[model samples]
Target: MAGYEYVSPEQLAGFDKYKYSAVDTNPLSLYIMHPFWNTIVKVFPTWLAPNLITFSGFLLVVFNFLLMAYFDPDFYASAPGHKHVPDWVWIVVGILNFIAYTLDGVDGKQARRTNSSTPLGELFDHGLDSWSCVYFVVTVYSIFGRGSTGVSVFVLYLLLWVVLFSFILSHWEKYNTGILFLPWGYDISQVTISFVYIVTAVVGVEAWYEPFLFNFLYRDLFTTMIIAWILWSPSDILEIHPRVFYFMVGTAFANITCQLIVCQMSSTRCPTLNWLLVPLFLVVLAVNSGIASSIENGLLYTLAAAFTVAHVHYGVRVVKQLSNHFQIYPFSLKKPNSD
Candidate 1:
């Protein structure tokens, strides 16, 4: 984490001239989430670092993912003849997810409240969020990928890519347009996923196996809700470690978004395609090339691991570079040197 400089001298200079720019026209974010965040931000003391709040929210989502992974590693927990995840886990997930979402909504306000807003905070927040887009979605898929009404893991895999695309698209929009038009779907997706989690807790996973209308199972309803958010806004290969595939995709997108954030802060043009995606594309191709399942699984794991290491290394270096450039600690509220 220390003595690393992945960001180039040119990029460091870019950071010197960086200025944060963004726009949020999202109705939910503007009208609902902002007001809610305004109230919630008051709960924290001024000394609290916004990055801490952002990181805490991210950990909650990670905890939810771990919980689901332990209980339903195969996404078949509710399939007949398999053990169902305890109802209480779902209840806990629901509450924790809402809390995480709330923290995400308010972290920026906390930054402004303390008068400590910095490019590092924005990078840290959005970078964690890029990964979070995967974790929470994978956690929620447990609800739809259970029992007789289960959506195919393949479908869910594709859905995860869509989620990543949405995330990167918003950042990419900022890259090109110079203002992030916060996607309308983001708020809707979070609220809907949390609601589904609680409902699953109340009615039990089996209740979701029943059809809702004209043979459209609750699983379809769930996936459709995700799709609906896309059409109005003009928006995987499951089996043998679906989440690894998701991790690969998520990291690829995260790198893209993080780079975009750098460019956004530095007022530079972001590349249209990231070199990281080249390896990701090759891995995806090899995995789907009818290769042996053992080999496919191995490839997924290797790619996921590679992407994670690279993304984290890049993130650390970028943060360090920004901290040096700005003369402020990454996750601290300490004042810069006055001498």
Candidate 2:
């Protein structure tokens, strides 16, 4: 098995094998988007590599970032005012983001259908997704205007950190329990982002800056809703179904607390292969916070470019290492083992 840590084929085939599989609790994805993605998956040629599909979708997001940079070079500026980029730019980015979201769903199906599924595929897909989450938030900040004060910057940083934490928590859950449970929040976020795009297209990006109810900015209201969901959903107060609330709120707290305890009790038992990588995110959070507060356009672009290159490099290294250890050529457009 080429030094690979292999699980037994019988174990893989058992009824509980995929019990922890990535479960999407989103109604829109379950009822509407998945069928559409299945159809799209069917259209892809068998010879087309699934990893390529995944990477291409991520590239579209990168293109979205570039488009923002090109259209509004002052987007990251420390200046207090918002950029006057055309309304169509927001519309274009919105459409591109939706396409990226759709393709993100399609890649896994393409992998399974073509028999090319591998751990590498899962890692690659998710690793890119982790980075894309940050990109999406940064884009939103640019549109709404970067926060100039320390408090505002902290709020933005905290929002970004929580989103990333939720993602990291999922991986930690899988590491501990061997199941990947996708929360309802993920689905709701996708739909909300899509809705944001449509709204931006209709009303223009400037509308987000206007005061809504009680003199709060529309963007502030949206942020408040997200923050409220993060804090309040775990309680028994919401009208959500019990099982769903448990899945969303209870699971998140458990994953976080469990991982923290593990890390505290035994260094070797940490769920992640690279524990240092986790802290690097905090460093990024701080750096980005400073950049947002100072409105340093040059540092912002430099950091973005650096992160893109470094992330891709790290992703390739992970895939290569996993491929070597598992003896599975994930880059090959071939079918995976049935077992």
Best TM-score goes to which candidate?
A: 1
lDDT of candidate 2 over 159-207, digit per residue (tens): 5556656776676676666666787787677667766766776775555
Q: Which residues of candidate 1, in runs, are more than 4 Å off?
A: 1-4, 206-237, 272-294, 336-339
- What's the C-alpha lDDT at position 49 in model 1? 88
User: Per-residue alpha-carbon lDDT of model 1 for 247-333, expressed as tens digits?
Assistant: 666676677778877777676666666667566555544444444433655666787788789888898888877888888887788
Error of 1 at 263 (Å): 2.1
The per-model lDDT (C-alpha) reads 0.74, 0.55
Native-to-model Cα distance after best TM-score fit, residue 124 in candidate 2, in Å? 1.3
Worst 10 residues of 1 by lDDT: 226-235
Q: For residue 56, give model 1's deviation from the true position in Å.
A: 0.8
Clashing pairs in 1: 157-236, 158-236
How far residue 287's Cα lies from its native spot in candidate 1, in Å, is 6.2
